[model samples]
Target: GNNSGNLANISLDDILNERVKELYWEGFRRSDLIRYGKFTGDNYLWPFKGGVLSGQGVAAYRNLFPIPASDIIANSNLVQNPGYN
Candidate 1:
């Protein structure tokens, strides 16, 4: 109930670990990791990142989803996101 005492001394890593346990399968992992600046770069790598067995950092632009090809073709003004093409 009263977690202030625990929160007072908890580190970012501790909070992240706890979040993973508490929010498993809730789809918050990507946002959480991005908020903590661990989504990209080699600082944090999960299983099979970039198709590598050991995992590896991905391009920074990978953070944003690419626009669909159909949408771009339909709308001349619709530009694809960076790093997609």
Candidate 2:
């Protein structure tokens, strides 16, 4: 059964309008706020869960993946990516 007839023909603007209506400004608002530098000033760091902290130490430079640990270990000549110790 071709059910395509049940769907209404829609344009990109129509889809965008529907998304704006459903999401109600929440999606783009965050980026707009951040672009104005609002996000950085606030306490934006996501709280690290207990397991992650225990395994990796308190969330610090070392907490981030260290240039993909396997990559760093395999290639002693390659410098570890910055922000990971």
What does the lDDT read for residue 64 in candidate 2?
Answer: 30
Each prediction's TM-score against the native? Answer: 0.81, 0.26
Name the regions of candidate 2 deviating beyond 4 angstroms.
Answer: 1-65
Per-residue lDDT tens digits for candidate 1, residues 1-85, read: 2555534466898889999999999989889988888888899888998789999998888788999999999999988898998
TM-score of 2: 0.26
Q: How many clashes in each candidate? A: 0, 0
Best by TM-score: 1
State the TM-score for model 1: 0.81
The C-alpha RMSD of each candidate to the native structure, in angstroms, is 3.0, 12.9
Candidate 1 Cα misplacement greater than 4 A, ranges: 1-8
